[model samples]
Target: MEWSVTDLAERDLYKLLVNTVLPRPIALVTTVNAQGHANAAPFSFFNVFSHAPPLVVLGIEGRDLGDAPLKDTMRNIRATGSFVVNLVDRALVDAMQVCAIDFPGDVDEIAAAGLETAPGRKVAAPRLAASPVQLECRETVSLSLGTRHRNLVVGEIQYIHIRDGAVDERLHVDIDKLDLVGRLHGADWYVTMRDRFQAPRQTLDTWRAQQGALRAKPEGEAP
Candidate 1:
């Protein structure tokens, strides 16, 4: 039921990976071109990597198939070395989809999506005003991989803006208030955070005690 990666076609591999990944966070990234023209794009191939230096990673693909031009977001990032990651919540999903359209380079996706922006505190890229969370990031490094114009970008977060009432004085965030949405299987599917469960982490002592209790139980009886 398994096949080697080398044997699979690129599109097939992409389908398998995306369909099985299950609930990936979406990043509605915003960046400004060299002329200061703003651009907004949605990328599900994104995630926060580290908190020590506050780093995030993004997987960006080239325009069209082969060695065409780079996407607007990638091009802007390369030109300015700065961008903003706007976490997509349920309320922002529709606008995020509007930003995903493959419009011409001259088009302003943000305005097309009917979204407003605010000036970034640390980066030149403007932040999506409606996004529950915005992270201002400076590119640390970018690696070009394969012949298909695939790129992996690593950015260090310079500043973060969280929506009011979402975080408390102790910095504890209210998940219900955040109401973030995640990319699900297939092209048009998505998931919400409302359906969730909790499983507390176990220590070695706790595990040992549980095992001992199980052993002391009568045969075929529940502990």
Candidate 2:
């Protein structure tokens, strides 16, 4: 049960980490190549890292074909310095999966996946028509992590597109209306955010009040 990470292969390590991470948000990223061809792909290793600058990161892997070069998503971002991060929802999970296929560079994954695209207001890449939320971003950094397999792409969000009912001008996103989908461990597994709860943060005064209430209880009584 106690396995050393150094002894494990890269693939095995990846499997272990991803499986244990639990319910990662799927980023259905869209980018356009220099020739104006669109590429769409789904990546589970993506998240919003900063709010002040509105930054997000996507972890992309290299291509399998010897001459295929970098992934279409990465190549397009590097070429245009812009991309779109579309949030996947339960309704569009199947289409999102189709977009994850390793299609040839010339092939338009969005068209192949039978998904519609709308032009982004602040970026050149098209946004998924079905996604509940879309973030138009400009690449701030693209750091190569390993020799051949991984690259960390950091982007600064320029514009965000949310469904009319999903978010408001106050930045409050309706969780139920958004109906966001998260990736599970196994292949093709996904979960919806229909069931949720809110746990408010406790301040110093609230903590002290709670302690006073507990202390006021009878000496032998259960808490």
- Please provide, for model 1 over 1-223, each residue's C-alpha lDDT reduced to its tens digit, 9 standing for 90 to 100: 7999999999999999999988899999999989999999999999999999899999999877455468889999999999999999998999998999998766788999999999999999999999999999999999999886778999999999999999999999998988999999889999999988999899999999989999999998966
lDDT of 2 by residue, 1-223 (tens): 7789999998898889888898899899999888888889999899999999999999999977687658888888989999999998888888887898877556677988899999989999999988989999999999998877578999999998888887777988887887898988867678887767899899999999999999999999999
lDDT of each: 0.93, 0.89
Assess the local accuracy of residue 88 in candidate 2 as a C-alpha lDDT between 0 and 100. 88
Worst 10 residues of 1 by lDDT: 62-71
Off by over 4 Å in 2: none
User: What is the Cα-based TM-score of model 2?
Assistant: 0.92
Clashes of 2: 0
Model 2 — which ten-residue stretch has the worst lDDT? 100-109
Off by over 4 Å in 1: 65-68
lDDT of 1: 0.93
